[model samples]
Target: MKKITGIFLSMLFAVTLAACGAKAPAGEDVKEETKTEDVNDEKMTEEKKDDKTSAKTDLNVFAAASMTESLEELKAVFEEENPDLNLVFNFDSSGTLKTQIAEGADCDVFISAAKKQMDELDPNSDTKDSDITIDPDTRFDLLENEVTLAVKEDSRKDIRSFDDIKTDKVETIALGNADVPVGQYSESLLKNMGVWD
Candidate 1:
């Protein structure tokens, strides 16, 4: 009778130990599963946010030469409000940018100082990467500018305005080419005011 009682007590202890070992694996599995799910949830949230912003706004800007300073300032304001989208500026002489755009530069916006370059692109000769390009129909006027006369800082002749340009002392002046917008406008201003005669 004493031996049977000892044997029964040993059997009970073995079963309890086996059950405790089996329970640990289930607890570990649950913890790992919770961590994986949390990571997946965070990824989904970021994806959704990116999709929403991308759908609303994205601009590729190709601006004229003289407007470089102003356009950069505007770019900061526009980009801050549009975190998900991008605004890339292609700044150069209108002539150069237009040629590049026509040859196919990946662009979404083109700001020209003169309507001529924009018009020329009307046939949109501009292209990017040999595949992508903007069509002419999307072209429109954004703004206009006036011509200005500036002299070398060291030179002092009291040449304050256009009238001062007519003097024989101003027979020769440094100016942009006629094909350039500034040049075109200056020539027109001179022609109208009888300075080029």
Candidate 2:
């Protein structure tokens, strides 16, 4: 976990530094030259053709619904930098995304809020379902989150914490469904506290 966190931080730092750099002034003429005369012109032409083909490719990213806001913000910056590649996002519960992938939905990238969903798709994991292929090398923890109890400001409930919710002082409670990562976490917490029935 520490290693993954470190890698994520490093990547975030690199992206921040790159985004801060100034771009070359507009209308400036830039010259290009071959590194060596031995370079094959045909190979170069073929590579350029491949690049053009790939430029029209659409990258489908399936991610948890909770990441919608942050991913949407990054989408604008990423699209501006790589105009040729279009990123199509399908945001939903992690479990739902996993089911989509299992059903052979087109996805170039998958970001799950919980490791459970990712594990189910990871070919290397013990919990993995057969037929799903995931590149383990590209997998890394992106962020950590906390679950908290919230109440309306005008509410008269005397809830102060998870334990408080177990008391009769609170009448009704709202929680995410089991398929949602937040819901799973909340359920786990409540179960651990001997409050979930």
Candidate 3:
């Protein structure tokens, strides 16, 4: 019985010693994960800094459909002088451009196709009342455009001038929107020519 008790105590002592030496693997794994996280965090911060440095002061310009070709040329010249300044253009009808500008789009400038809609905003070409996120006085008319009543190519209809559109069978005329500058000019031209009746 005494020998058996000694053996049992020796086994218990060995188990206690082994347990004292054995550390939880969980702690080591947690440390390794923390190291990995720190590395990722450092990498992400560096990437963010690089992006900030590379980012340019891009200026967004919305122009009229007719000014598409002309504006592209202007953009090239403007960008050359200001290399760090990027010029992005959105060319479309005046009505479309006005609505976008009114919605408070993040554009630096607006070159409206039609002065009528743009004039409704203001001389500066800003948005009307209703939550304007950008600067109010960021719009201006670069130049004026004239409108002419043009007929389709190779049409046999005798469309000599504005009066010709009023004649019979000239009903399906393709004109710009009323608020569009060209459309407004066209309307004025027809009214002055006494062909609106």
TM-score of each: 0.59, 0.70, 0.57
Query: What lDDT tens digits, residue by residue, belong to model 1 across residues 67-174?
Result: 888877877787777664556567888878877766656556778888777666554444222232345566666776878888778876777788888775565687
What ranking emerges by lDDT with the best candidate at the front?
Answer: 2, 1, 3
lDDT of 2 by residue, 17-130 (tens): 111233445554241223222245655666666655455546788989989999999997997787666677899999998888788777778899999988887777999874
Best by lDDT: 2
Q: What would the C-alpha RMSD of candidate 1 be, to one decimal place?
A: 22.6
Q: TM-score of model 1 relative to the true fold?
A: 0.59
Candidates in order have lDDT scores of 0.65, 0.73, 0.61
Model 3, CA-based lDDT: 0.61
Ranking by TM-score: 2, 1, 3
lDDT of 3 by residue, 99-149 (tens): 776675655566676655555445343534333333335545568676766
Instruction: Give the C-alpha miss distance for residue 136 in model 1, angstroms.
Output: 6.0
- Model 3 / residue 110 / CA error / Å: 0.9
